[model samples]
Target: MNILHHAVLVKSVNITSVAKLLLDNLLRHVREHVASIGSLSTMTVATLLDPRFKTLGFLSRNKVQEAVRRLKSECTALIASSEASLPHPSDAGESTNNSSELWCLLDETVDQKRQSFNATADAILEVEQYLVEVNLRRHQDPLEYWHKQKHVYPYLYHMSQRFLCSPASSVPCKSVFSKAGRSSANEETAYNHKQ
Candidate 1:
């Protein structure tokens, strides 16, 4: 995008024509494709989680707000599902005649619930605060950063885990496929020569 902008400022006919065409077509394609990409909640969440290009530095205020809301809701759902999967106190025991023990059990359960609730709220707050910080260095890995900060933002960290494994681009996949093909051909040739 910067290259195109600079090319447009040049006083050369050849560069101007090419840059104009590129800018026009590329802008149109990007606008259309970006809108469709925004529809993918997972991808949007992943983009937001990426510290390098958090919010893509271009998403509108409303769009950013909507994405944050969606991320928080998804994180909340995951938290709820995980907690539901755990054994409940009532399910773990039969009613007993010991009132003091029952009171202790109830108090512990309540404390646990409150702690989880506080943790979730803290995670959301941390995410918002993180958004205000300067972007990560270009060389830094967001996965590593998020992984290290998991304890600080447990829910967001878990939410990021779901989306961060995705390949950032198709170039690496194509490169791997070509490398595999070459290795297979080399192995086949070697086997035929030996046989």
Candidate 2:
């Protein structure tokens, strides 16, 4: 099938999968970078204490201390920013209620789907926090964190484009699927009537 036809058939697939992929990749990149930094720090500390490396002890000690300070600052900022950005569960109740009402007005059959979507959104928010926590422990630089996050922007943009073109429904996928199904059914009926 052509691209457009394939897109129609896959209407039920959530575009958020793209976002999730980006988020996961970003997290993994950050984690690996942080791990490398941690390993380097350990090696630096180890070298500084080695008797054979005493000639370089003073310089190595200073370098290690500087690295530790930088790491600490990065960790603090990451934790603080993540905590600030987290979606409070209390807010979910209000937003969920509003979304549920909107979905009910659009299609009563999709109330459960709307709820599930909200739940998934909440879960993603939580996952973001968890990633922050895991990465913060390693204490990488803020610039590096931003750099890692930048990789996901294109994916996020693609997901946003899909979302924008999508129909207005409380449950995003359900709404898109319903619209597609309706259109196909109407086309089939017209074809039969013409016959």
Q: Please, what is the TM-score per model?
A: 0.59, 0.19
Best by TM-score: 1
lDDT of 1 by residue, 1-195 (tens): 222234444634556677778657644554455555555677667767777767643346777788778777777667766776676554446455698678778877886887579547755776787677777876898889988888877777887788876643332334444665686699899999999
What's the lDDT for all of these models? 0.66, 0.40
Model 2: residues with Cα > 4 Å off, grouped in runs: 1-128, 133-170
> 31-135 in candidate 2: lDDT tens per residue?
443334434543433322222221232223445465434333433444444444665333233345777777556653454355545544543453234224432
Give the TM-score (vs. native) of candidate 2.
Answer: 0.19
Question: For model 1, what is the alpha-carbon lDDT of residue 67?
Answer: 78
Query: Distance from true position, residue 34, model 2, in Å?
Result: 34
Q: After superposition, how far is residue 14 of candidate 1 from its true place, in Å?
A: 9.8
The Cα error of candidate 1 at residue 108, in Å, is 16
Worst 10 residues of 2 by lDDT: 46-55
Q: Where is model 1 poorest over a 10-residue stretch in terms of lDDT?
A: 167-176
Model 2, CA-based lDDT: 0.40
lDDT measured at residue 53 in model 1 versus the true structure, 0 to 100? 61
Instruction: Name the Cα RMSD for model 2.
Output: 27.3
